[model samples]
Structures are given as structure tokens and as C-alpha cells.
Target: MKLVIVMLGLCCYSALASAGDNSKGKELFQTNCAACHGEHGEGKHGVAPRLAGDASRWSLKLFERAVLSGVDDNGRKLKLMMPHWQNGSFKGDNGNAPSKEEIAAIHQYLKHPR
Candidate 1:
């Protein structure tokens, strides 16, 4: 009985689903983002950003834009608050950005974390 139970537990743990196992992205966010972005994904009033939704607040493509180029979705002056990602703006404190493959993982993690 004890052996069976142990095996069962191991199986269940291995079977656990990882939503977009974007650990790197998640870690990165926690380190570099949690300050402005909320720990639970909730956004603050001003300081940094609220990444839950509100693409229009900046722009739908702003994430990619902000990552690659310094332009906000609206194509206005770059806000001083948002740092340029390419300029080594992201310190080593956090994990690196998600790759294309990891986007789904990151999204899954954000949408549903284990």
C-alpha cells in the first residue's frame, strides 16, 4: 500500500501541467517587473505598469515594440518611465525575456500559474 501511494503521488506530480513554463520570463518579471507591475499581475497607479490587460492604454503591439524598439504603440515620445529593453535596461536581477516558443509558456503561466 505504501509503495503504491508513493508511486501515485509521483505520477500526479509529474503529470501536473505547466502553463507556458516560461520560468525565465516569470522570473524576469518578478525581479525587474514586480515593482511596477503587481506581484499578482495587478498594476499600480503610476510608477511602472499593470500588465494584466489594457493594451489600448499603451498599444496592443507595445510589448513587442517596447522590447525591440523604444517606441510606444501610440508612436509618441518614449516615456521616461518605461526603460528600453535592448539597452541592457533589464538588469541581471531577473530572468531573460521569453523566446517566441516561450511566449505561449509565459502567457500560460500568467493566465494560470501552478
Candidate 2:
């Protein structure tokens, strides 16, 4: 029984560590991405592609690359408008770059926007 409990606790902790916080994601998106991606990630016409469900097929690594390096899944460079966020170009939240956890949260929100 103790072994089982320990296993269950580890599983729960792992799940929590992997999952991103939806609320934090929404806030970060609104503060940093909404201007270009739209309030609900609907995207602006002639500016940015719609983000809602756009990354449904993307792995987290690919998403991270695109966000942090401006490289698409095809290994091609994204448009110039896409900021390489790793450079800390974003002006939101005291102009600091988004952490990995924060990026994951944004991905979660984009994956399942409410």
C-alpha cells in the first residue's frame, strides 16, 4: 500500500509538472500575443495567421522552436513579423523573455482556448 501510494504521488507530480496553467497562459497571451494574434487568437487579417488550432499537429519542441527561434516545423524561417522570442524582444512583463514554463502555458492556452 505504501508503494502504491508513492507511485500514485509520483504520477500526479509528473502530470502536474508537464501540464501548463491555462490562466497564466491566457494572461501572457493577452499581454504579449493578443496584439498580433487577436484577443482569442483569431489573428489579424494580413498580419498574422490564426493561432487557434493552428498548432494542433505540432509537438511541443516544434512549438518551442517556432516561438523561441522563429523556425517553423519544416525547418524554414518564419516571416519577419514573427519575433524570435529568445532574444527577449517582447516588451510585456517588464520586457523579460518568457520562461519555458510560461511558453508552455501559452502553448496550452493556444491548444485549448476557452
Q: Judging by lDDT against the true structure, name the best candidate.
A: 2
- Give the poorly placed runs of model 1, Cα more than 4 Å off: 1-20, 56-61, 93-114
TM-score of each: 0.54, 0.75
Candidate RMSDs in Å, in order, are 6.3, 3.3
Query: Mind giving the per-residue lDDT tens digits that candidate 1 earns over 1-114?
Result: 999999999887766744234576576566665677577456677665555554323432455565445575667656766665555445562546434433333333445332
Q: What are the clashing pairs of model 2?
A: none
Cα distance off (Å), candidate 2, residue 55:
1.9
lDDT against the true structure, per candidate, is 0.54, 0.81
Collision pairs in model 1: 20-105
For model 1, state the Cα shift of residue 105 in Å. 6.0
* Tens digits of per-residue lDDT for model 2, 1-114: 999999999999988866744788888888888898888788899888787788534888888898999998899999979888998744556777768878778888888787
What is the Å distance of residue 51 in model 1 from its true position? Answer: 1.2
Which parts of model 2 are misplaced by more than 4 Å? 1-21, 89-92
